[model samples]
Target: MKILVINGPNINMLGIREPEIYGRETYDDLIAYIKEETKLLNIKVSFYQSNHEGNLVDKIQESYGKYDGIVINPAAYTHTSVALLDVVKAVGIPTVEVHISDPDSRDEFRKISYIRQACVTTIKGKGFKGYIEAIEYLVKHHS
Candidate 1:
């Protein structure tokens, strides 16, 4: 199986952005972990992180037919990007939303997720392991 992992907004600043809330692991570390995990499952995955919402949306839209499923961490855009949601819906690809921190336990603004409703599942609060978890879950549940 093949998967596209898209990270949006401040995600490029992973380890440096906010250590307390987002954790100390870098996005590259998370990608390495996902790569290892997917290798074990015999799955292929492509990862991309962007601070631009439109670029992320493009990535999601481009995944249609090119990927079997999508795993995304839209960062701050998760609560704000209707464009991303539209692309996800239009692509009709299986998707999983991931977050390093549990937004529900944070400020109210961080708690709202416009993308969750459009995903197959949401994984949060597990740090970088969240991505690994999402990949595993998405692959398992895909027919």
Candidate 2:
């Protein structure tokens, strides 16, 4: 199966940003891990990361008819972007929302996620492993 992995804003700073919360693994490390894990599952995965909200929305729109599923870590956008939620809904592809940190455990503002309702599932607090979990779920369920 083929999957699209979309990461948003500041996710590129995975290693340098917050060691305590996001772990010491670099963004490259995260990508490597996902690639390695999915390789074992015989899954084809494409990745996209952007600090721009419009780019992310465009990517989601572009995934239509091209990808089997989407694993998205919308980062800060998870709590806000209705545009993203709309596009995901419009695309009608199976989507899994991932968060490295549990948003409900953080600031009150972080607890709200506009994208959750649009996703088939939400994986949080599992760090980089959450991405793999989402991929596995899509492969097993969506495929």
Candidate 3:
């Protein structure tokens, strides 16, 4: 199975930005963890991270026929970007939206998600484990 993992905005600042909520793991650590997990599952996974919304939309658009499914953590864009949602919807790939921190439990602004409607499932509050769950879900469901 092939899966595209996309993270946006401040995600690259995971360890430094807010160690309390995002944990003390660096972005590279997160990548390594995901790589290790996917290796065991024998799933081909590609990763992308951009602080720009257009770049993210472009990546999602580009995944259309190349990937079996997508695991996305749109970060700040989750609550604001309709373009991201449109592209994900347009791509029509089975997608799982992941959040390291639970939005519903945070500030009101974090609670609104424009991309959720386009995703097959949304996983939250599970930290880095959320990404693993998303990958597993897509691999199991993407036939």
**Candidate closest to the true structure, highest lDDT:** 2
lDDT of 1 by residue, 15-119 (tens): 898798887878788888788777878888998989998888888887888999899999899889888888898999999999888988988998888888789
Task: For each candidate, give its TM-score against the true structure.
Answer: 0.95, 0.98, 0.98
* Alpha-carbon local distance difference test for all models: 0.87, 0.95, 0.93
Task: Write model 3 residue lDDT over 29-136, tens digit each, in one string.
Answer: 999999987788987899999999999999998998999999999999999999999999999999999999999998999999999999999999999899999999
lDDT value for model 2: 0.95
- Which residue pairs in model 1 clash with each other? none
Q: Which runs of model 2 end up more than 4 angstroms from their true locations?
A: none
Misplaced by over 4 Å in model 1 are none
lDDT of 2 at 61: 94
The top-ranked prediction according to TM-score is 2
> Residue 51, candidate 2: how far off, in angstroms?
0.3
lDDT of 3: 0.93
What 10-residue stretch in candidate 3 is worst by lDDT?
36-45
